[model samples]
Target: MTEPGGGGRTGWVAPLCWSAVALEGFDLVVLGVVLPSLLDEPAWGLTPATASLVSTAGLLGVMVGALSAGPLADLLGRRRAMLATVVSFSVLTLLCAVATGPWTFGALRFLAGLGLGGVLPVALAMVNEYGRSGRGGSATTALMTGYHVGAVATSLLGILLIPVWGWRAMFVAGALPALVLVPLLARYLPDSRPQPPPATGAARSRNPVAQLVRDGYLRSSVAFWVASFMGLLLVYGLNTWLPEIMRAAGYGLGAALAQLLVLNIGAIAGLLVAGRVADRTGVRAATPAWFAGGALFLALLAVPLPGAGIYLSVLLAGVFVFSAQVLVYAHVSQHYPDHARASALGAASGIGRLGAISGPLLGGGLLSAGLAYPWGFFAFAAVAALGAVAVLAVPRAVPARAR
Candidate 1:
């Protein structure tokens, strides 16, 4: 009997790594949920603008962390890198509960972001290695489903606990995985790294990241980075401003908020649908199709249809926009050999964070200029279409050798 991750290994590693991804998701949602209370307290001095800065601060740290993860994962094995990152973020998240002011809170979140940003690529690499028969799409999509699950769980916790225990307790909840997951991962997860053939010896031990763009991989590598940029830009932009965008279009506040919930529900449903399709159709084909669908659904949002029609559009947009990006991750995992896999993912994810930062900023800018609604939605549709074009630029065949 053979295993997908490696021979003679139990199926425990993927779940352990996935739990780390979920922890980051939980920690992320906690910040979003807690910010309102922080603003109301006044002691924190969290103006909406300052709160946005705090958000960007964490994202910047995540960008740095993500950029570094690939190199570090290449230097240290994936399991070790994953463990260190999970511990780093979880411990820092606990520190967030004790912060004295907005600056301190923002600083802690920034530091925690380093750990949060670093883990996903490593985890995705592990899951991709664990699965077999080039099922990168199904495996990665299945793993990312844990992210939304973690996000929804934190949203529920915010509602239940923040009112009683307050926001600090919520951060504390985000920290619990350190105690449970770190040990579980150490015990259960097998190390994943590429095996350098004996022929190369000392010569082959060059930078893994440099291998991504040399020879046959340059075109695909650039295309993947650009596609990831567009995908995440759409994701963060819409998640941050969707409610506000809808309200600007004249929908009631309650309906706008309800649409967010519907969107996330659609995201969860889309992940399952996409995983199966990507597994069969191949990520190269499926990812672009999803993004194309996202563009259409998003463009339809500008029309202000009746209640059911609007809900359907929101749901469909949610389905395509988020999963389309994850499909790219699937493609990357399948594209690179095992050794360079984490580095490739980390680079792409790091670049995508730029888009994440831009999305909210772009929407906020448009809102300030009174151009948010049709223009914002139109811009989002255009970006999704651009992502599809980027995907199409990926080379049909990339050399299998690690350069």
Candidate 2:
């Protein structure tokens, strides 16, 4: 690890990267947690559809941010970009807490989404660069695990704090981590050395996204985008509606809420483990199997199984759901050279953000139509199977060093 500042502990880098990802996780989940409270507030005047629209807007902002942040990070350097994104989202979230009306809240969330979108790719790039070469998959997975941790924490906080303090408190709580951590990030994070342009010369160096389309990379890129779409679709869908799903499946409200916790715990473990396993056996080999298992698990949930089966299904779903998308990212980082890595990651995430938006909408549509719980799980399973096959179809590229 070439310590950008000085070297005592490159160890701190992975943890900091994880912390940054945790903030992104918080931003995504907190709104869902606080939604019921927000709807009940006369001041906000949120109808169910309106509230859903607001959530969709945030996803759109995230997509825009994801697509744009990579080139910006490459131009700006990773450390400055990551810290700036953290501070930017923090301030926007604070604004969200203070805003009184729907318009203001939506606008703030959109801006916050920009910050939220930018942080992930930059963080992933940094971690991938600093992490031991053989352990890139595991290191990236560990960093991403923080996102699940934040999501789980926010869910608990919402259950505990909202009865006393209301939805604003949740946003306020969200802001605190960034405020405390931004300074630490500002001081400690190291910027990876941006790779110089390809020696093929200035003519070919124009657009990084365009570069990805050349050299047979177009196939891999499309496969990743499809896989990411399915992965995030499952993630956001479950987070948005798991409680309701559980309640419909005959669990009490308390048990329904607890299942979310159990699911995220599995996610955390999956992130920590998936990378190491992928590193040992190519990311290509590891990811398809994970998705297939996830598909089966999600399908199993739809059956009116015993209590143990429900918990087991959720735990297993969490294992594959979150890590599967991240493994796509690791594959991109490993597949692309550094100069284009961020851009590729960003594009894939940007595309996947579209899927993220759809997940909630799909869930709401299914639930509104009174589709059986099994159909929903079956649908998610289909998505997973599609993603697995999509990933498998793309021809694997040999690393240049190996080539």
Q: Pick the candidate with the highest lDDT.
A: 1
Per-candidate total of colliding backbone pairs = 1, 0
Per-residue CA lDDT of model 1 for 290-328, tens digit only, reads: 999999999999887975999999999999999999999
Return the lDDT, model 1, position 110: 93
Please provide, for model 2 over 199-240, each residue's C-alpha lDDT reduced to its tens digit, 9 standing for 90 to 100: 663545445666567656778888888998998998888877
TM-score of each: 0.95, 0.92
For all predictions, the C-alpha RMSD in Å is 2.5, 2.6
lDDT of 2 at 51: 82
Model 2 misplaced stretches (Cα beyond 4 Å): 1-9, 159-164, 398-403
